[model samples]
Target: MQHLSILPILLPLFSGALLLLPPFSKTLKRQRLLAVLSMLLQVVIGFALVASVQFDGVTQYILGDWRPPYGIVLVADPMSSVMVCVTNFLAFGALCYATGYHDRTGGYFYPLFMFQVMGINGAFLTGDVFNLFVFFEVLLIASYALLIHGGGKHKTQATTHYVILNLAGSSVFLFGLGILYGTLGTLNIADMAQKVGDLEGSVAILAKIGALLLMVVFGMKAALLPLHFWLPKTYSSASAPVAAIFAVMTKVGIYSILRIHGVVFGDDAGELANVAQSWLWPLALLTVVIGTIGALASPTLKLLTANLVVLSAGTLMVCAALGNEAATSAALYYMVHSTLVAGGMFLLADMIARQRGKAEDRFVVAKTMDNPIFLGILFAIAAIAVIGMPPFSGFLGKVMILQAAHSTAEQLWVWPILLLSSLGALIALSRAGTTLFWRHSSSKQASDEKQTIHLGEWLGIVLLLGASPLLALFGGPISELTIDAAVFLHDPSLSVDALLTSPLADGGF
Candidate 1:
């Protein structure tokens, strides 16, 4: 039962590796069949892991039987479990979509796709700080490869920018990790939390510095305010399915901020307690304000969605900065909602662009889409969810976040910005939708001339868009679970205890 935590990581890792073998890699059809079955299993295992945590509080698996403060641990509290489950669902949907959309026999798409999922799962499950850095590299490499799977000038250029920026972030990450290890004398996250408050004077000050550096590293990844320039290009140039899957990547930065800030350098960490703490709420507001403006000003559908992703990241960071039980719960809910909606929009934008021919998804009067009814329906769903309208998880998440932040010192600023951003998003999306769908050139191509969106493509978009309501339908239980997760996080000692106490069933490999 404890070992369920490792299955998410292992399933994708082994599956991707096996698929890379000649016997499997030679046949794309077989690979696709295996990938779908593998992902379905992953989704089940992920939910099981989430269930285990809610029932058991914390579930950790130690590698090589080395135990906490020494061994690598994979811990699943409700938060990580939720992320794992959502990631698996998103990957499966996106993978299924990609199958019919892309050339099944072309390049290393399936293998790299699985590896990308593996990296994401590893990031969510690893309990050691250094290993977190390792997983980031793993995911980044896979993304770099996948970004250019079928090359284009824009894609190649965007991939280069994305790679360079991330590599620099990786370097910053390593430098901070070194200082962190030197200050706390440990790399295990729970151990660091256990040890940080015990340090005094110089070591404690250095620890704070390390925490700040790590914050900057994660900040870049999350596209927080001043650090967000790389996003528009990266998303605008990527293929539809690739951009959709990348939606969860930003959440990694949010999760890292929450984990590292809420646990290791938490309120109990002596002088390090408030490290990078002051910036969360204010930066989130600024990010949203800037991002909303950017989205409004964006000239293309791809760019608009990219800007919206930045806006969503800022929204989640508000909770990270609040660092309270309610705020954390709200943040988790918002993460899931934003990821699904944003992913669906990316794919929809891609399909729209393909249908628009040379005009692409530019916010201009262009030819009508091949399937305007299907596209309009899905696009409207995504847009409504993005703007945080009623009857969707976005509305629920915002309500929870707003309610959670009402008493915080930052509320005076937070409330208005969120409200204003939503309004702005509504206006921007309305205009874009009208321009793309309602107003069109008279020289319309025949129905036969439009691009045929494959079943896999529609299924992928539908699954992602459909999840918003599913979240709303299941809101009660999920919220309660997030509150539990938040309580566990608020008291990092629970995580530490769980890591220390988690029994090793396999002994040593």
Candidate 2:
């Protein structure tokens, strides 16, 4: 059981290293096979971990066999478990999609992709603040490489900007960490949480400053409002799988905020908590407005990228602003839904671009919508999910967030902003859907003989789309899980109680 805790991070790290070995250098087939196997292994491990949480509650593993406040700990609570499962699922799906795209890029794609997974898993599992920074850098570095994997002038330009901006953010992150270490005398999050309330005067002030600075650094990564200029261009320029993978990157930032705010600075005396609620609300609202406007104005697939980034920021901001159990759970739900929906859409965009055989005119009719019923249906479902239609996972998640927002004094602004943002997303998506699927073209539709989707691609799409319905069926349990997770975030003592008393069961009392 203890060994299971480290498997999530170690599996990918080992697989990634093996991919770089001499024997694997020439065999793309073997490399891909290994990548898929490694990813599936991780997914299975993630599910087992989540199930463990459901049974025994939150699980913590200390590195180097040392006790808390002294040694680094990796927590496998509901929140981290949820993120790990989602990240692994998407990693597998993206890898499947990349099977078709791999030949277009060189053999290096799989290695970098695996390393990215390593980073994401590490970020989700690490219990130390400084290790969080380390894993984030790991993911960002891999992403920078993957974004420009195609090596075109446009991709190069976008990657350069993306790399530089993120590098600056990374520097800010480290500086903040330094300040935090100096003030708290410990980098362990659990220790910081326990000690943060006792610090006074100058030390407390430095801690608050450090927290705010970390927020800025993460805000850039989350692409919140004014800090989001780099997202659209960079994502638009990258290949679809790259963009899909990058979708998980924002969640890293959100995870950082949730972990740090909910755990480290959640106490009443923490001045930074107050600042997050007051300042983050206005910033979130602005991001919602600007993101929607950008989507309404843009004519390309890139618009979706911008819109989703804004939506993600708004969702996280809601979590920061509300800082309640229900609100944090809602944010977690939204994070999972948004990442999956955005990833599916990116894959759809890639499929459409591939079918057209040209990137310049993405909507050029390659085959009649009727010919590929599966593709058309999947695309429609994805579009509906992104727009938050009823009976879908997206709708349920949004409702949860709205309900959380209603619990606050700022309900007036929250309701209006959410509605307006939903409206904007609907209009922009409707226009794009019309262009991509409904619009007529002069070219003749491809015959059944000429148009086909790989079995793997179909399977991936079906599995992901099927997840929405599964979420609907298990709404009770999943909601409970998210609520439990949120509760754990709000009060770690409850998590500690569960860990100490329970044997880890399927359902909690």
Candidate 3:
């Protein structure tokens, strides 16, 4: 039971390493089997982690017999455990979809995929800020390779820009980390939370600047305004499965802001309390506005879907900026909903592109699809889910966020902007669906190239998109869980005490 806390990171680590060994390395068939099995186990372990945290309050797994504020630690709280579950479940879908044909694009796909999952899980689980930077690089390096797996000029070009921007961001992250360590004398998140309030004058100013720099890095990762130009092109250029998993990548930044800003600079931090909200609020609104406009003007389905990711990130940021338990809860529910649906949209867009010749996912008239009715159904459900329509989880998530905002002074700005952004997403997706499904040319039909949709593809799409309605179906318990997670996050003392005060007497297992 205690070891379950680390399995999410360890399973992927071991699986990825095993894939590099002789028998598995030589055979793609073997690789696929192992990767799929590994992902399934990861999903199970993810669920177990969530359940463990639910039953045991905050579960801390200290490494190397050392206690926190000194030793490396993996803390599985309600929020992080749920994020681990979402990442594994999403990875399972993306990996399944890749095995369909995309994995065949390169020999190392399975190993790289496993490493990518490992990095994301590590990012979610690590309690130390330095390790967060390390995990960020781990995922970024794997993603750089994955982005170019299929090998296209556009992909290469996009990957190049992606690599450069992130490298710069990584450098800035180090600068911020250095400043924080120098000023606060510690890098553990819980320790820093304890130390931040007591700083005054020069040291406090340095700490504040360091925090803001880190926020800039996080904002770039979340695809907030002015730093978001890389997202649409980068996402649209990748293979479908890679793009699908990348949907959760943005939420990693959202999670960071929620964790760092909420716990470290929270209202209890005295002088540093709510330091980020002033900056986060206006930028979040601009992000939604600009992102919605991008979606409206997108010329392709993948691009439009990518912009919607930006829109979702902005909306989540708004909730984070509000900085309350209710707002945090709303952000959690919406984060899961948006990540799943957006991933499905990317997969759906790829399917549509495959069926449409010459006009591949672009908003141009081509012959009707092989299964217009079926694709139309999926597209409609996706649009309704992403656009916040009734009976789906998107609407419910947005409503919760809106309801949470009512208590904040920013409700006046938050309500109209959020609702209008939903309207904008609705309009954009409706136009895209109509263009892809209804507007077909009669002149020259598509060649008799029969595209066989694989069962794995269907499984992947259904697993992700289907979660939307199911989330709405089981909204009560899920929302309560999120609220509890929010409450846990708002109180940093619990984490500090769990790690530092009451550690196990025996050495870490």
Candidate 4:
């Protein structure tokens, strides 16, 4: 169990490193097989970790006999466990999709993909804030390589902008961490939370400033308003499988916000408690408004899905800004709902582009696909789920969020923006669906040049789209898990205490 906690990060790191070595590195098929088997093993480990955390309460593993507030530790609770599970699940599905669709592979694609997952897993599992920064860079660097994988003009352009912007965000992140460590003399997340609670006056003010700066860094990563310009072009230009995996990347920032604010700056956080609310709430609403508008205005299917990605982030951030257990819980549920739906939508867009020839997902009157009905059904599922239609997880998630917001005075503002945002998403999706399926679709449509859909691509999209209804079906248990995760975050003493006091582990938890 102790090893399991570290394996999520180390497994991918070592696997990626070994794949780049001779013999294995020369064979793309061998590399792909290794990546798949490794990720599947990770999924199993992630599930067992989640189970262990639930049974044993919070479990901490001190690295190399070092303890918390002094040495490195990896703590697993409901939140990190579920997050790791979701990330590995996405990586597996996307890898399957990549293997089937990509005409060329090899290169650093397989290795970088593994490192990307490792970075995401590390960010989720680490108990130290500084390690979070390390993981963020790991993921971002791999993403930079992945972004330009195919080597095109547009991709190169997107990669340059993305690299520059994230470099700036990284600098801000380090500066904020420096301020925090200088103020509290520690980088361990658990210790920072406790020390943050002990501050007063000038020290509290410094800590708040540091927290706010860190929030700004996370905001850029999450694609929040004013910082979201990089997402549309970057996501739209990336390869389908890459874009699909990137779906969870934004949610990474959301998870950080929930974990940091809910634990480090909770109600007992003195003056810093809710300090971000005054600015965070309005920014979230504006992001929703802008993202909706961008979706409505997009002329291409990939671009539209890209905009919806931002919309999902902003919508979830509304709950984060609310800063309550119920709200955070609902936000987590919505996060899961949105990630799958958006990933499906991105892959679907790629398929449409592949089949549509010159029109290439332009939302204009293009040729109908070979399996129009099959493709159309997939698109409908995505649109319906994303737009929050009934009997699906999206609707349930949205309703839960609205109800949670009702408990706050900001409900007046939260309700309208969310409702209007939903309406905006609906209108945009309806127009796109009509343009793609209704007006352009033809009975006489046929294409000798149409590319046949592969089994692997179908399975990938199906797994993602299929999850929405299943989430709706299992809504009770999933929601309960989110609520439990939120409760642990709200009183993080349960998460932090074990880190400080747990005995050294030889092998297992």
Candidate 5:
């Protein structure tokens, strides 16, 4: 079971490497088969890891038989394991969608996709702060390639800005790591958590600054206010599958904040306990406000979905800022709901674009689609789920967040902003849906061009969209898991003790 901790990272790494080799490299069919099989295996392995962690508690895999506070380790607790499971599930759906035409537009699409999954899994599983930085770079490098896979002037321009900003963020991340390591003397996260409360005077000041710098990097990754201007264009410009998979990338930042700030600098840390809460609360609220406005002003369905992603990020940040187990649990639930729904929305928008001829996904009247009823049904389901309507997991997720906020001082602020944002999202999405499906131009000539809808694409959309109802139906057990995970995260001793004292494993937990 301990060995399973590393498979999530390794499966994708080796699969991507193999996909770049001869037979797979020359044949798209072979590449698709390999990628799908790898992802299917990943989903199985991910669930196994989650189940093992749930049954056995925290499990750590020591590399080279080395011990913690010295050697590299991969730790699997409830939260990280669940995240891996969710990521693999989403990756599978996105890969299924991409096998249609998105993969054909560029070389190494399958390989790059696998590499991106490897990086994300590594980030979730790694127990060292420095290793987190390494995984961040891995994911970012792969994403840069994936974003421009189709090759267009607009994509090039978006990628250019995305690269510049992330490069700057990466530099800041390294500086923060240097300062933290210099002051703390160890980059192992469990070790850092143990030692953080012992610092004094100048060293403590430096550590605080370093911690906040890391927070800045995380906020940028989460697309918090003032740093979120690049997201809508970047996401809207990408191909459907790329955009769909990119939905989970922001949660990576949210996870980091929970792992580092929530655990390392938690209530137990002297002077640094909950250091990020003050700034996070206000900035998170502002992010919701601005993101809601952006969504309302969006002229295209894809752009609107991108803005909604920003809004969801802000909502998740609010939960993080609350600094309680309830909030954390709610954040986890909402995170999953938002990622799946937003991804479905992106794919649905792309389908609409394909059917609309020159009108694309823009909110404008165009010739009626070849299959309006079918596409309309998908769009409505996606819109209802994304807008937090009842019977869908999104509504339940938002309610959990609101309930978590109740009795807190920030409730007054959080309730208004979050509810208002939902209202805005509803208005914008309703307008887009009506414009695309209701108002039609009979005067325009019927389109001679028709894009083929692949079976894989339909299954992909169903799998992702279908998650909403499943999550809702099983909300009880899943919520219990998240609640336990949140409690586990708050108490760092469980992780530290497990990492430090667990006996060497020969494929047994």
Candidate 6:
């Protein structure tokens, strides 16, 4: 029970190692089987871990039998658990989608995929700031490898820029960590949170500066405005599954912001009240505006790249500005929805490109809806989910954010900007959709022939798209869980009391 937190990190590491063995390399069929089975196991374990956290409130696993403030710790509060589930689900879906494109790459896909999962899970579960950095590096390295896996010129160019920016970000992150450690004398997040406010004078100011610098580093990773130049090029150039996987990578940035601001910085609206309301709010608005404009201007599937960046920015801004229970809940909901929809669209694009032969394969609009009905349906679902249509999870998330924004009616600017950005997203997506599906195909070949959707691809896309509704249905209970999660995050003392007062065997929170 104490070691449950390590399961998320260890499972993926173990799988990656096993897949590298000779036995698993006999054939592509065997590799696919192993990948699916391993990912399914990961998904199951992730859910179990989430359930355990809900039942126990907050579960902490001390490394090497040493207690925290001395040894490393892995904590599973509701926030980390939700992240674990989401990372693993996206990983599994991406891996499944990669099966069709395996021949395009090689035998290295599964191993790298597993390593990517290891990094994401490690970052999510670690309770130490330095370990989080280490995990981030691991994930970034895996992503770099995957970005340039097939070795095309476009991928190479894209990856070069991606690597350069991220490496610089890593340097900034390390410098900030050094400043933080020198000032605080500790790297453990729990201890840092407990002690951060007590420091005085220059040390305290330095700590705040360090936190802000770290935020900038993560903001780049999250594709925040003014630091997001690398995203469109890199995402558009990478393979579909790789781009799909990268879609969730921004969540790492969001997770860091939430953790630092809400937990380490302490959730007093008075302490950093002006900073949150002024600087962060205005910056968020800029991010939303820039991202939407980027989407509108992009001509190809590249537009999704900018659109996702915008979505991430909007979600992060809402979470940062609102900083209420409802805002955090809304951010989490939007994060989950955006990750799924964005990833699905990438995969759908991959399927379309595959059917069309090459990137340069002339754009051919589907004359009969039946010709590309499967992908058409997928595109529609993803588009609607992204655009925040009714009954979908995105709508629910937006409603929560809007409610929070309205609470601060004094800040009259929030609603209009949000509304305009929503309109911008609709227009950008409509144009992209029109170009991809409704526009007449200039190529006569498509008119003379019909392409069939592969059963595996069809199944994967449909199931993935259908998951949005299932998430919506569970919204109520999940919201309750998120509320509990937010409470625990904002005040861990409440969590400690809940855990101690409840019976251990029944896993009561």
Cα TM-score per model: 0.96, 0.93, 0.98, 0.96, 0.98, 0.92
- Could you tell me how far off, in angstroms, the CA of residue 295 lies in candidate 3 after the best superposition? 0.5
lDDT of 6 by residue, 255-349 (tens): 87777766677553223322334556767778888877877777666556546566566556667667666677777777777787777777777
TM-score between candidate 1 and the true structure = 0.96
- Runs of candidate 3 with Cα error greater than 4 angstroms are 443-446, 503-509
Q: State the displacement of the C-alpha of residue 241, model 3, in Å, after optimal TM-score superposition.
A: 0.2
Task: Show the colliding residue pairs in model 1.
Answer: none
lDDT (tens digit, per residue) of candidate 2 on 133-240: 889989988998899897889999999999999899989999999999999898887777777778788888898889888989888888876888888888888887
**Model 1 lDDT tens row, 300-362:** 999999999999998888888877889999999999999988998988898888888778899
lDDT of each: 0.86, 0.77, 0.90, 0.85, 0.90, 0.73
Cα lDDT tens digits, model 5, 321-411, are 8888899999999988888888888988898898889899998888788778988888888888888899989899989989888675678
Candidate 1: count the clashes: 0
Candidates ranked by TM-score: 3, 5, 1, 4, 2, 6
The segments of candidate 2 whose C-alpha lies over 4 angstroms from its true place after superposition are 270-273, 359-372, 445-452, 495-509
Write model 3 residue lDDT over 278-303, tens digit each, in one string.
Answer: 89989999999999999999999999
Worst 10 contiguous positions by lDDT, candidate 2: 500-509
Error of 4 at 158 (Å): 0.7
